[model samples]
Target: MIDIDATLVNVHSEKEGAAPTFKRGYGFHPLTAWIDHGRAGGGQCAAIMLRAGNAGANTAADHQQIIGQALDQVGLGAPRPRSGP
Candidate 1:
């Protein structure tokens, strides 16, 4: 399974794509996907997408793209075929 989330990275210097976040800090918000190994707690990162700090967390387009990249990283293709009856 895969888990996706986003976090704000604090920045001390001016940089492209950096903006004010909800946390009232200047930085970049990056979305990341991780492979859940189950029972193991933490997992390996599958994909990361950098965005401006002001980017919305509930953006459907970004989530879809990130999910697709994560699936690809795990060797899964789009429109995965169903197995078992």
Candidate 2:
């Protein structure tokens, strides 16, 4: 399974790619994708997209791209369909 998440970072000073967030705070909004290992153990990170502070939180395109990145990390190609339920 793939887990996607985003968090707002508070920028303290001048920095590249930094901007004013929706909360009126200055920082960045980074979108990340992770592989879920569930009960097996700790998972791995698949991708990270560093977006500006004012970036859209629920953008469909961003989510789609991130999902594709995670799929690429699989390296085994697309999983085959289950033969039976």
Candidate 3:
């Protein structure tokens, strides 16, 4: 399964996409997707997209785009890692 999440990153200086965050800090917000491997704890990052700190958290378009990017990154068109030793 794929789990998507967003995180706040603090920036010390001005950055191209950095902006004031709700936490009253300046930085970027990045959305990321991870492939879950259950008890194996072998999850891997599927994709990541960066947005300005002020970007809305519940934006549908952002969610959809991130999911699509994650799918494309790990889709059948891409080779999967070897499953066995």
Top candidate by TM-score: 1
TM-score, one value per model: 0.85, 0.80, 0.81
Q: After superposition, how far is residue 9 of candidate 2 from its true place, in Å?
A: 1.2
Task: Rank all candidate structures by their TM-score, best first, as comma-separated numbers.
Answer: 1, 3, 2
Residue-level lDDT of model 1, residues 5-78, one tens digit each, is 99999999999989999989999999999898578686999999999999989888888888888999978856
Write model 3 residue lDDT over 1-85, tens digit each, in one string. 8888899999999889899999999999898888875787788898888999998888777877777777787663454353335
Instruction: Give the runs in model 2 whose Cα sits over 4 Å from its true position.
Output: 37-41, 76-85
Overlapping backbone residue pairs in candidate 3 total 0
Rank order by lDDT, top first? 1, 2, 3
The stretch of ten residues in a row with the least summed lDDT in candidate 3 is 76-85
Model 3 misses residue 49 by how many Å?
Answer: 0.6
- Clashing residue pairs in candidate 2 are none
lDDT of 2 by residue, 13-71 (tens): 99899999999999999999889858876789899989999999998889877887788
